[model samples]
Target: MIVSNVSLSGCAGANSALCAAVGDGHQGGGSYRSTLSPTGNLVVAVCLGFIGTFGLLNNLLVLILFCRYKMLRSPINLLLINISISDLLVCVLGTPFSFAASTQGRWLIGEGGCMWYGFANSLFGIVSLISLAVLSYERYSTMVVPTEADASNYRRISQGILLSWLYSLAWTLPPLFGWSKYGPEGPGTTCSVDWTAKTANSISYIICLFLFCLITPFLVIVFCYGKLLCAIRQRKYRKFLAALQYVFGLTE
Candidate 1:
């Protein structure tokens, strides 16, 4: 009887442990299922598809305009090319990840994916802004001093493009190298540099906007307009004086 009771007790204890293990597994499975549902997955897939499609179309249009038209092949158009390329990257690389995040409300791509997305997005943003600045400067130069504008060389344009790419890479590479880092908010959601984490990301974006969009472009436009006004005034004065000379000669 004693031996039989001991065996029964042991069996009961084993059963209890098994039950507890099963219970814990059930809870874990439930939590995971709730976190990643089929609906969420579908949403993510759709978002990525749409973003990719849009990017493809936009980039193709830009490429067509630049390639097919000789009239559009100028310094200003070169800057547009850079902008279109950057926008293409943003649509192809950055937006798909963003769509995943938006649909799933989490990051599905993991740490490596997050870093890649952040880097591409940041790089393209910088390129777009720099291209805008270059375009503005080119327009201003063209208007302000048309003669001097003819002096822009291939070397200068190439240097500007290189510098813009380098500037973009500088902002993007740090996060990849761990000097900074970005991660998904969750399973299907990714984010850029943690702007809310008291990092310099927000500040850098603000400074870039101020410098390229507000300060530099504004100054260029103003200077260009001033030069235009002076030119117009001089032209009018010369024409008026010529007319007066003709009138006096006819009268005499």
Candidate 2:
């Protein structure tokens, strides 16, 4: 069946699926298939519907603010705006259809749509993750290193943002080239990587994607925040010592 959707760049011609049940709490998944009955599905639909609507409005407003106000156009704000863009994509593209499918207890977007929705869902999710890691590293660098604190690193940050999208494209595009594949999963209510397929190509893609995409970004986030925490502790210790020195000097 033909699926109608606004064309986007990554994996437009590819078939795919959304996050598995294990990944995003979506109905279709590995061992965690959707067990929701009609009534339960209705409840889920209500919750997801509300979240999608509210998030879309909020993220869209932030994006507009960034564009409307020059003062808001800082380097860090650029990263944040990108984050908002990714979230808004999820809201507008992934949420409604998935929720509707859940409610109906089947995939409604047709075969091609299953691929489109899944492709979109994966793309947005990776963008969000990488943006967050980049945002945290940016914050840490600005706070810890005084010299590189200004928007002088704007070029680098922009490059990083570009790289984030590129990285997402790198992983998502493989299925189209036959390195891996995407299809319906978990009770046929959702779509995602065919995790059940244990072909060598699929396994390799999964391993590489997990390492470069998931694990790498996660480590960057943790390392940046970890350093930031130590810096905070040291700053507090110095302040405490300075206060004691001032009091002792007065007594002397």
Candidate 3:
């Protein structure tokens, strides 16, 4: 159903599911509105509820485990805790409104709420992705160097975590400043970076976000893990060769 205040003229003749022109009271320009049926909205609400609940509990468990166990507080594992924190924030700050909107079959909050949801989710999600990349690199470093110094390198770990958050924040803020925008996304239940806007600024922001925030982190994770696998295989191979040589020498 269209927002009560939103005019039918703007979204007229457009597919309800795909329409993004529904104007809200707060946003004189327009915002997205879901035209989904009641059953569909119920399904969406149920799914969001499940995901939000499960994610919140799971991440909270991770944080609790890390905090309770001193051995789990290693410089490397701190990255995992960072990821958990970001996930937990997403569940807390982002999921509830979406869940509420889904239950109501439209965005319950106004434009300001939409923008806040979009920015908050994007920031936290990007933080989680960057943290994963950093964690992979940390693992690769441990495997490759295996140094006592690196194992206890709390300073390095802190720097990595700080960089992950700062880098994610840097990218997510541009939308707020009008580099692109943050608005309602699919089904109008959630909000995110505006992907449909074709303006130069919006297009540029999307391209940069895709490359730097997403692609860069993905490539880092792949490269680090690839090198790690190679190192492990080589170590195993050497161990096998040593075992074979010992067996032959004993036989001789």
Score each candidate by Cα lDDT.
Answer: 0.60, 0.75, 0.83
TM-score of each: 0.61, 0.80, 0.89
TM-score, cand. 2? 0.80
Q: Would you give me the overall lDDT of model 2? A: 0.75
* Top-TM-score candidate index: 3
Candidate order (lDDT): 3, 2, 1
Q: How do the residues 1-252 of candidate 3 rate in per-residue lDDT, one tens digit apiece?
A: 224564557656654543653654335443446767789889999998999999999999999889898878788888888898999999999999999988877676777888899999999999999999999998999998886645449888899999999999999998888688887777777888878777899899999999999999999999999999999999999999889989889434
Candidate 1 regions with alpha-carbon error over 4 angstroms = 1-52, 147-152, 185-188, 199-252
Which consecutive 10 residues in model 2 have the weakest lDDT in total? 23-32
The residue-by-residue lDDT of candidate 2 on 128-214, one tens digit each, is: 899989999988987886653366678878997997898898888787668777667755566677776667988998898889889
Report the C-alpha displacement of residue 241, candidate 2, in angstroms.
1.0
Q: What lDDT is reached at residue 119 by model 1?
A: 70
Count clashes in each candidate, considering only residues at least 3 apart in sequence or on different chains.
8, 8, 0
lDDT of 1: 0.60
Among residues 3 or more apart in sequence or in different chains, the pairs in candidate 3 whose N, CA or C atoms overlap within 3 Å are none
A best-first ranking of the candidates according to their TM-score comes to 3, 2, 1
User: What are the clashing pairs of model 2?
Assistant: 16-115, 17-118, 17-191, 17-192, 18-191, 21-29, 28-186, 29-186
